[model samples]
Target: MQTAAAVTQKKLKRNVSLAFFAAAVVFSLWYINFSFSEFIGGIPIFMNFLFTDFLPPKASDLPTYFGPVLDTLAYGVVATVLASVIGLVFGFLMARQTTPHPVIRTVMRGFISLLRNIPFLVWASILVVIFGVGSMPGIFSLILFGSGFLARVYAEAIEEIDSHATEALDAMGAGYLQKIKHAIIPQFVPGYISWTLFMFELSIRASAILGLVGAGGIGSQIKLTMDLFQYNRTSTVICILIVMILVIEFMTKRIRERLI
Candidate 1:
């Protein structure tokens, strides 16, 4: 089915693409002043620093982190719940199949885009400035970012639902609310739960670091320890964070497996 000229053209295009990719790699390396020798030499230095500075974490400081850890979990839980509710509403508005109007959908899409484009840490920093350093700012930041992300994904999930049920509802002259409740909700619930769980995991990580910006949570402990040149305590906080994340991830995975 292929002509000789067509095959030749395809080969030429492939070669050109490869050449451009190679050139881009070379340009990036030069632009960054990349040095293979320095990169190789840095590994041992990094290892030494890690072992000397971060090893043998201070176990005694664990008791002091209880309140901060709880605050971090609270921030993540509240943010994720609020974000999921907001996302559900906006998701329906943004999806083509469920949208009330094209203009509304476009507006919502733009708003969500704006929220999602701004980094979560940046949101925390800005909010902290407005509200002053506290859990409220960190929680609000996570909610804003999570809502944007979930709204986009939820819209996609809604759009991907089987059309047969919706079509039947339409044929029966069902109202928008009726159609959504009877058709969309059933299909969307599983994916919504899964995505929300993923968002919660991300929120936990984000909340942990929000303290670096004076937003509040266990991350503030990290910042304080680092500021005091207490690497041992810093390592302890980091380990706790790691353990918390791992436990959350494991729980989420199990929940998804059972529910989704």
Candidate 2:
């Protein structure tokens, strides 16, 4: 279906794109000072360490981790609940169809952007510095980051809803709250639940990592064990963490399937 010139042009474009991609990869390797020999040399050393130091996890430490595991779950649950509420409010404000004023929407959008752009660990670290290392900082960090992320996604979901219903409400002289209550809420609930569950999973992982900075969770135990060079204990904690994450993931998937 193509002329010879068109086919040649297509091949030229493909070749150019490949050339650029290869150049970029080469530039990146050079920029990072990557060494093929060093990378090859490290493989056996890494395997040796994995087998000699980190193998055969100390399952004896499992019972001791129960409380910390509970704390991690609590942090995630609390943060997800709080963030969902906050995100709902902001999402309504950010949605162009639902916003009361353009200026308010702009301000809320900027605020949400600020919150979402910062890494969760960075947020945890900052809060730990301000509030003194504890669970509060980690929880607050999850809340902040989750709120931003959920608000953005919620706003997008709201925006994607069929506009005809709201437009009809507008034509019927419906109040803003009436339209939101009758139309937006009904449409948004499923997405809200799904996104909230996803956020909870992320919050759990973040909370665990936050503990490394003394924000308080199972990760604190990990840091302690690693500090003591108790690699076996560290391995045990990691195994527990892996199990917890897998369980949460399974539950979340099941819940999403049922609810959404």
- Per-candidate TM-score against the hidden true structure: 0.92, 0.92
What is the C-alpha lDDT profile of model 1 across 1-260, one tens digit per residue? 99999999999999999999999999999999999999999999989978998788999868999999998998889999999999989999999999999999999999999999999999988999899987889999999999999999999999999999999999999999999999999999999989999999998898667989988899999898999989989999999999999999999999999997
In candidate 1, stretches whose alpha carbon ends up further than 4 angstroms from where it belongs are none
What are the clashing pairs of model 2?
A: none
RMSD of each: 1.8, 1.9
Indicate the worst ten consecutive residues by lDDT in candidate 2.
Answer: 203-212
Give the RMSD in angstroms, all C-alphas superposed, for model 1.
Answer: 1.8
Q: How many clashes show up per model?
A: 0, 0
lDDT, residue 253, candidate 1:
97
RMSD of 2: 1.9
Tens digit of lDDT per residue, candidate 2, span 1-260?
Answer: 99999999999999999999999999999999999999999999999988889888987767899999999998889999999999999999999999999999999999999999998899988999899988899899999999999999999999999898888889999998999999888888888888999999998787668878999998898898999999888899889888999999999999989987
